[model samples]
Target: MKKSLVILITILLSAVIYGCSSSSEAENADNNTEDKPTLTLGQTNWTSTIVPTQIVKQILEDMGYNVEVQDAELGAVYTGLSTADVDIFMDSWSPQQDQYMEEYSDSIERISASYEDAGAGMVVPEYMEDINDVGDLKGREDIVNNEILAISEADPAMEDLQDIIDAYDLDMEMVNSSEGAMLAAAEAKIEEQEPVVLYGWEPHSMFQQLDLKILTNEKVPEIYGDTSIHVTVQNGLQEKAPEAYNFLSNWSISIDDMTEMITKIDDGQNSEDVAQTWIENNQDEIDNMKSN
Candidate 1:
């Protein structure tokens, strides 16, 4: 009897100790997970960046991460990424933005291509049937005459674009305005079938909402060539948030997809609703990009 009682007591004690250890380990794990650092993202006024930024924010939150976004200027975004004030910047246009990148290349790193072939160029409503290319614009200047080429607020890339205009000695006026203002002007002009030329790029609401054509510029060199945009992150972001970085590195959306999103937003659909709709509809794309 004494022997049986001692064996039973020993087994009970061992089980209690084991259960405590397992419980302690689980508690520690929960605590460690709760301690993970929050991620910070930076966004500019560009819709191309804005839409993706929101998508990324949603994904990070789903991954149990704390994410914050700051609306900043182009220069400020680059500086923030370089200095690690921001963890990631979803909109970095290359070659055109080469000057800014070169200045901070040492501190900032290019994570991946967000959306390639995005940049500023002249675009006309599809109704302007004769103006098919950049060369054609010179002949039909009157139709597009006094029609200012709207541009986003002062950005270094805009400066490079202006240089191209000067080099080509193009007679059109480049109107300096906010992205919102430019879009509003473009919208009004398109509504009336009035001819206008404006700085345009992909992943924009205008592209989806309007039937337009991008005027081809032959004078632009091929190497510096086709315009493209990239996704850039702070120098230590990968090491800091490997999961978020991986999602961003693989994340990409087509001009058509972005255009549709922008169009929905412009047409009075709430941005959050539009974003949720996109996320739910494109689960496969998001899953492939976000998978380990």
Candidate 2:
């Protein structure tokens, strides 16, 4: 009887051990299946980028994504995306950003177009009817004396502007300052009805508030070298967060739409308010993108 009882106890212990092992494996599998993916978005320090980034964030949140926004430099953003530190970037300007793209194409994925025809050029107040084009600036140098040409800090466009200046031999001096400072200067001048010429671009709040006109030039191409800002994703982001990637791939906004949102934000509306208002106004567009 003792021998039979020992054999029975050993068999029961073996069964219990096997059951626990199977349960542990199943639990691990369940945990792996239930894990949620986190996505990172990279943003540049420009109003054009900021408004759109916020808009993109709202759309992704609506689709149930864990999203993080990282303020990054132009070059660093590309590097981050290549290394998977950033999962998405919505502000990749091409031709201008072509160098980075070529270098990192192996690691990162170019997803879709964000905005096209983001034109850049020198702009003057509407009152300056005399200066219709870049070439006209040379004849009116006396009138534009102390006329500060404001520009963003370390902008790549400055190089092109410099080339134009050198090629045309214009007398106007280009003033380098932060975007805020430049806008402040331009706004102050505009308020006083003083003549001011500054570097400006589309899809910016300044377009809505300031009565400025972009100076046409034969030298500078109309479309800035066929450059369109693009959406980019990390190598495996599509597989990890397919929903978010799909939404991003379909994301696009017109220059007019962005300008209005930027105008609201510049007028002291909060970023979220600006974004929410724009999203509400453009519900159909947003729905179509999301549905697709």
Candidate 3:
């Protein structure tokens, strides 16, 4: 009977020890998960936006973060950031996006300028020497088939283009299309050395692939103000992911480097691979970004 009692106590103690060990292991796993919070980054499909977002994504993942990328239109991207449905947005064109910023000012924070010399407006091939200004397109509707190739109508730049058309009384139609389609159209036109009017911005590979010029418009300086690309985030991102926030706050890339990475991406290279190559070559810059 004493032996039986001893055996029973041994079994109970063994069971208790096993249970405590399992519970401790489970708690450790939960703590590890809590320590590495999943970060969701908002991205637009534009190549300029994709390159930097992917670079930042890889950097954060290297820092032991579980990163999620959500691609959406500009409006939806902004809305997601504002509501904290998304944590970071790498590309926010200022002044042009000022209205959205104003609307979501209370929820979104502009982290830093990614690049400062970005320009957006009507662009024409250099061959079209006469088409140097928005007003220049007024009489050359036939050359462009009475069309102004542009991106989605949801874009604020599209609205600005419409206003420019009405303001200049250009007999041109704003043909709405995707960025890919617009660039394809512009490419086809450029190959033939033909004249085409399309929306253009810096930090894009097109400027490197083709000889193009951004047309000026004196009538709407406000719309075409000195454009600067910014990195924006949800209001709580700084406190929620301080490491990621610090990396982004110190992030800035040259127009030349961004354009080169964009060209690589446009040429069928994987964006992450392109980013990795850039990161490898730019360790000093990357280190600076993470210093604080």
Each candidate's clash count: 1, 0, 0
Ranking by lDDT: 3, 2, 1
Could you tell me the lDDT of residue 216 within candidate 1?
71
Question: Per-residue alpha-carbon lDDT of model 1 for 23-120, expressed as tens digits?
Answer: 99999988867865688889986777777788888878888788899999888888898889898887787776778788988888787776766645
Q: Please list the Cα RMSD from the true structure of every candidate, rounded to 1 decimal place.
A: 4.1, 6.8, 4.6
lDDT for 97 in candidate 1 is 77
Each candidate's TM vs. the true structure? 0.83, 0.80, 0.87
Error of 1 at 135 (Å): 2.4
Q: Model 2 TM-score?
A: 0.80
Q: Residues 1-292, candidate 2, lDDT per residue (tens digit)? A: 9999999999999999999999999998777555657678898878777888888888777666667899987778888998999888887776666667789888887778878977667788888888877888876765657354666545566777677676668877788887888888888888988777788877687765888888787766633456588888888887888777777788888878778878878888888878888889889988888779
How well is each residue in 77-144 modelled by candidate 3, as lDDT tens digits? Answer: 99999889999998899777888999999999898898896888889888888778787777768888
Q: Is 1 or 3 the stronger prediction by TM-score?
A: 3
- Report lDDT (CA) for all predictions: 0.77, 0.78, 0.88
Tell me, by lDDT, which candidate is best.
3
Among all windows of ten consecutive residues in candidate 2, which has the lowest summed lDDT? Answer: 146-155
